[model samples]
Target: MTLLTIFSQSGKYLLLSIFAFLLISCSESSPPALTTTADSIYFGGTIITLNDAQPSAEAVAIKDGKIIAVGRYADIEKSHKSAETRLIDLHGKTLIPGFIDGHSHFSEVGAQTVLANLLPPPDGSVKNIADLQKTMRDFIATSPIVKKHGVAIGMNYDDSQLAEHRHPTRHDLDAISTELPIMVSHQSGHFGALNSKALEKVGITADSIAPDGGVIRREADGKTPNGVLEENAFFGVVYKMFPAFTPDEIAAQLQASEKIYLANGFTTIQDGKTTKDNLKLLMAMSEAGTLKADVVSYPDIVTFGDDPLLQSPLMSRHYKNHLRMGGVKLTLDGSPQGKTGWFTVPYFKVPEGQPETYAGYPAFSDEKLNEWILLAYKNNWQVLGHCSGDAAVEQFINAVRNAQKIYPGTNHRPVIIHGHFIRADQVPAIKELGIFVSAFPLHTFNWGDWHRESVVGPERAENISPTGWFLTQDVPFSIHSDAPVIFPDSMKLIGTAVNRTTRSGYVLGAEHRLEPLAALKAMTLSAAYQHFEEATKGSIEVGKLADFVVLAENPLTKTRANLKQIRVLETIKEGKSVYRSTEDEK
Candidate 1:
């Protein structure tokens, strides 16, 4: 063969060898392609992603409880085209991220189901003391659940709404049951009333001194505790009164409570004030695989002081089987509506027993609060503080500032709960302190009229919650129901945030009203962020959990007045329907 012919043959072999080497390298080094098949594809609904990058989508593809793709319906349909994929038609509904309750008492909300509901208007029609007594009597007569137990309990009784315009005392509760120990919890859960029998049964007598940060209201003699217990005092006694529920009983209550939350579109809910017993119960429920929605609890820091459980590495944000112990919960003060919240100014209509100069007292002193804050900081624990009054807000701000100075980190994400009376001046400080505010906007509607006229005076009451102030300050804030204080009604909550209207139809803090989308964020992405589960749970983004709520209408397009009217058609958790409304579309 000629030289040219030999060279051509060599080139062919060399090229072939190079091609073979390239193929081998590609096969060995490249990552395997991700599975494109999806378990479900939701379409034909207006999807509010709550994701800034892609705020709206027509379709979402989910697989193994995660969002795999979100885009136009045609695009998702074309890519995941297959017969096995379950297609969900929204039926002209609107879908948004599953709500995350910023702060609430999950267990308490469930307990309300079994307890006599003494709530005033809207939730229950307890017009006066007589109505409350009658309700309790009726429950006692009818409920086998309560009748089976030795003691009797009723919940969510609000004095402010009573026609008598006062708290139900032992005399009132005695009307329900003097034979069996009877107790009625104030709507705020910061105060409660016990009958003479209950007071005696619990060993609280005239000789018993009030515990620190609590009060046992006295009679004219200044010796008799007239059945009223405030703050720590009430909690201490009531906790002991709780019957030992079996694990199954506890699980059943949890499921019942979660149903309410799920109906309102919450994927993650919180128990804002948990005790040691509650912690154990929650852990048991978690271990038993009974919790349906994600639950994050915050045990009372004062009660759990220096406990090994609080100090455990396990307590630092552990989520398993949809249950987590987020951190410690502290009460700087009590509830404003209950007139026990520490405030800078005196209440407009002070109770009969209180001095005109009496401002509600703090649950802990500045030094004690500082110590607790330091403990949380040192242990790298998130703190959720209940601070409804301005004074309490100030104390919280100082404690947080001091804590950060000692151990600084922007990622602490410590939260201020309630903030019902958060002052305009304090708004900037909250922003500067880098803390999150979970305001009780539901207070605006449930008790706004009463607050303006009775609790805090019109001027201060108008500014209650102050969501818009947080917005202007560019601080992270979200709206909450403080459930059992009010229902975990997300539509009602967002509507109240947007409307700031009271039950009496008065526009309160109109300036403080949030925009529709902003209100939605408070319940969705913003709330998830407060709980430190934003990345995994909040918003309808790819790779996030397939958790969403199907609404009858898009909140953004609806009129402000109609926001609350937008019903939750269905609540989807991990692409499975957890709640579906039985009522016809309104």
Candidate 2:
């Protein structure tokens, strides 16, 4: 009963009192227990959430094709761990939100794969008109589908890179084959050349006048059509000229096309421009369960006009088979690189047969454009207009302004596509009018020199796709590769947007170059916003779609020179793997 006994008794009493207090406090209020388990846990990699709020995460948990949690591996695992959960080891790779191309013609990707490659250097090697003819001839000889269909089709023919320094006319295509109808599309997809047979098949004659908002280039005699068609004319004839594929063939073609997009890490792809017939085919493919990624299309005004399906309630925000019609598209002019985009100034050097005082012209009159725009506005349809030149952009601004007067107080999220020639002054008008731009920045790399020397002159060329201007003016914009014009490579898009470097090692618009992280956001969050799907997609947030792409290296860490070299290892959509590279296959 000395000091040792007294100390021991006092310590035991203190421990018992503290324990009793803790038990009483726990009994008063208990925290909720974790009840839901994740279906899969991905860790051991650099996970870029692309969500500015959280920014980055060490791990992600997914359940039912949605992100359940994103944070430190230990914390997320503690809450979502279960016996049935699948553990995904990233193997030291990098993960990002699945890319959403700002603008593209995804349906045409199938045709591009099956058709002859007529693109110039970097994508294909057609250096001149002679090379183009030979490429088509070789393709026709080897393709049983072309022979069976009795039509030879080729795509991505760029005049800017051709040795002849001119567009290949129908006369040029006729050299490839007069017996079978031959059609070669300009790389821009805004113009096309058809052989005599194709012209006759479409009923174009020396006396045939071009449709409004379209042009039928004629020979020196001013009577015989040269076989080159622009803008609306391209759609009118080519839409009917190509041999129709059966439902099974279309489904197969679409699946093959989606494989290419998936391989490039595009989870949400746009067809950009579609016809009612093409929409039907897409719908059929969607219903047949052949679609591998989300598709958002904007039908051309000509194709969307007066259609019962488009006018129905189902047309607004309607989704089927992972496909949705974002809105109506209007081609205000043609391609700037193709020399048909409307401009306020004359080209430094006009095309071979053109007038000396000519500037490019618009597809349709303002009155007609306004009518179509007002129709879309009144119907609450999102309008996506292609305006490659500043003049064309002005046309869009005026049309939208007038439409707003008729249908006031609505934020419809109207968009301007390929506003490559947008100037600093026009940026204010675009923002004031509450319009968004989806610009084609790839032109800087592929045709910067040509635009400077010939298309728009050095003054205007320096400002093409002026993204810096947009940022300064606080305007919303996104960058894109008008696919099939350029390969739909997301890495290339980000690289081009960040570096603004041409193939010949020249900086086109150094001021317009975006930061690597900002460029990535353009292809993800901004692209999703352009299609009005920002809340449900774009970022790796909780309750959002589990779409992601695994990269070999982190884009933010990769040097600008090595950006394009970064390969996509895998593409995931809805928590399901849609594409795996050869490296993964091994």
Candidate 3:
């Protein structure tokens, strides 16, 4: 046959073979070529996997975004190394499973950046009257936006502390523009200040009763609204004034926060609270391949409690790549420090209120809280309830207990997040209920002093956020920074956990000091395990996700203080170098 005829015959056979192979492989085990093969081998560094048996390693092999080999360099070479394999020598740097920040606000952090640039608050430290005057000036500059409905008002007032030390009163905001409405949120998000015009816009007056899960501040005479909105009450004001950002704008912001997260060494993050709009934005970004950070978004269920998505369909699943839709996050109570949370006992220090006998409020009734937990547990959703104070903790525990009674043998990993100011007595109950905890231990270090003087008295402050209590009780718990609120740099978390020092450099709880390895585990495998992804990632092990970080120093061998100084050299995701400090993006 001629060369042309021979080529034609060969092509026909190749086509037939391709069709046959596709059919056979679709019904059988993975094909040899399709099965991952390594392109790179990391052959140096102290690899810490958080797996107890093999806590450290000398090498790892990456192929198809998964680790095919993990062991000593010689061992990995025997099973996985190739002749043309790209080699990375870590030069004795520390390597561990990439940091997993269990709670963060990447979307909101971006929003905060934008708002801060567009609006400036008066320097709060400059005496009370001066600060108010500064606020008035800033409000005028932003008041022009009132031309657009729901003008952006109250972007700068901190409601926690003031001469009156309350939410910026409508009376004060009236000085800005009564003709145009305005609403400002508290830095804590627990409260909000509305201008007189905005209050009328929302139809909230002194006679307007507080909603079931919300509160409205009123003057002592109960004759007029004080302009402060709390919990669910503030939602209307925020949503009314909330400006919608475009998809591209949201993508840009998400990317920026992703960079911040990755730079600080967090490979994964869970948005503890998100809105439907935020969820839509994430969906848009994921479809466009713009979402770089691994996120498990759990939006607020309480706001939309009647939605079937929250009850029967407890945990929603997303395509497994980067962004995921986690279980719904509900804040049962407000911050303990803010004194808005529901507690069994009254707050240590009550703000200006009608009665001493009144315990702080809860958004959901006990019956409703129980109903929500039961429905979530029944649907097998992970309930990450934001409960910080002892009273809120107890309410959460009771709700969980009631859920168990209603539906037995439900292995729900209901997490009592924050665990702030929890007493030792609460642990046994929390453990008995089989709830997981993700403690914010850094608060013990970062805000311990402020917590000492104001929230919980200094004498009792040492008892706040005790990680050791959970440890001693064998609780299945993880620790995290409520990032944006506090950045989740693993080193800072470690420094805080091991030192138990406040931001002011005062050591608060010496007894609560955890080992360095313990802190690393919390940020890695422990966090991964919390999300039930331990089998796939969270460790430098054979047959797991090829996700690990190359560091400039070994945190394990270095001095305790050096843990804070350790730096990430490179970040690898799915065997690909996704980010590098010195090199250009490939």
Candidate 4:
């Protein structure tokens, strides 16, 4: 053969090989063809999948409440389009996975809806002591709850935000009602104040001694009950004085709470630290098909460890009628802002009536904590421990470490809820132990100044929540609202996590602030993973639940300042519109 002829043959063979390679590459990159028509197709605007494989998508198709396809709008439309399919035009809105609750008392949020709003400035109008008293009085006169329940209840009153910077005493609540039994909860829900009538009704008196892990503030004489209760002391009065709700009343509260969560773009809600009665009520509500959004209750195992109800069929991973038992909740300590969180170092400023060297105290002995955690491990149950202070965090870590040694091969996925004050050094151990942290960065905006000035001082205040540390250590963490402690405002939660801005407009923990996308993941994918629902929920992946929120602005594209202002235009759950902004109707 001639040399020119041989060269020509080789060149032709190389060209054919290149063509074959290109064809295979294109085929591999192309989206798979859809086999069935979608029940609904969402397209236009931004779709953040939170799926690493496909970080963004042009369209999503859903059928029977499960995602069927996610890819380019053209591909999805061409393959999955049908006359009966619902085409949801985003109109330039941003779609994201519906938020899952990190940790919050869902039913208590329902109860808050009925109580007088005492949260400071943004969430409510009670900014000072006078405002608190006046609000309680107004609620007494106007609220049907007061008349029906025969008691006045107010929630979210922050001593830190009050004009006087002190807890409202029985004297202050008495100003609102001398005849009526009145109680006002500190914003942390770890402390409370009761009028003389309510205190007397609850059987607390000068002779009453505080519980092991709680305090009842006393008058100057050191013997008179001042009606300001803390931790266990406050909880005891709550159980005694709070009116019993009929099943119907409890259902109404749950309905109201679910609406608030839905309006805030949360699809999965956590009713953390649930009581036996409350759990039964929730189960009844589920059976009655009254729940619209998914609720996962972690009953107070400390109180009902022996209750046969803990072994119910409802304790599975699957939801039945929008409700399921996630696991158990254990409170290891109280709130930092309330000055009750267990800490190794002394608080910047001790609470009134406390010693100068006060560093707070634990909810129970370490032995008890270890015992409970080991029990959870033995049962292979996921346990969520509320540890807001470093000392409490240490106790939890030690307990978990011991439990793991005993029950070594199981994937219990024990969680540290509200590790708000965990030390930087502890992050490594947390990562090693696989302890998921559901932090409360919302505290930064709500009480960052208070923490700096009065709680833990400037240096330590900057580390509250410490999401940045978790990120640096490669520890899995999620952010939460701990609702009823504050409103479950998802935008505010995201904004605070991103900005770490105090109410005074100062960025308290600038270094600890998360990027917008990371903050969103803490509430979505990370949160779902925390709850072991990552496989079915969290992202807009095929076979996942069709749960999403439509935002007025894309968080990824917006300036940090504008993030909190982004509105939830619509919330969809299980391929259905659960909440639509009234503005959308316009």
**Predicted model with the maximum lDDT:** 4
**Can you give the TM-score per candidate against the true fold?**
0.92, 0.93, 0.83, 0.93
RMSD of 4: 5.3
Q: Indicate the worst ten consecutive residues by lDDT in candidate 2.
A: 312-321
Positional deviation of residue 431's Cα in model 3 after best superposition, in angstroms: 1.8
lDDT of 1 by residue, 248-299 (tens): 6766777789999998999889998776666787888777876778888888
Pairing residues by index, what is the TM-score of model 3? 0.83
Q: Cα deviation in Å at residue 40, candidate 3?
A: 1.4
List the candidate 2 regions with Cα displacement exceeding 4 Å.
1-31, 584-586
Error of 4 at 474 (Å): 1.0
For model 1, give the RMSD to the true fold: 4.6
On residues 1-586, what C-alpha lDDT tens digit does candidate 3 reach at each position? 7655766877878878999999998878855543344678887667787788887778878877778777778866766666877888777776788888767676776665444221212223422434754655564566433333445544444444445545567787776678767666665566778788888877887778887778788877977898888888886557766555666666677777777777777777787678777777777777678666678877777655656544432245544458776676878877655667666666556777637655577767788888778767776677888887777888888888888888888766788888786778889988898888888887675457667876666766787778778778888667787765555576777777877877577778777678888777877777787787778767788788777777777777778755777777777767766677874322
Clashing pairs in 2: 213-363
Q: Decide which is better by TM-score, 3 or 4.
A: 4
The per-model lDDT (C-alpha) reads 0.86, 0.87, 0.71, 0.90
Q: Kindly provide the TM-score of model 1 when superposed on the true structure, using C-alpha atoms.
A: 0.92
Candidate with the larger lDDT of 1 and 4:
4
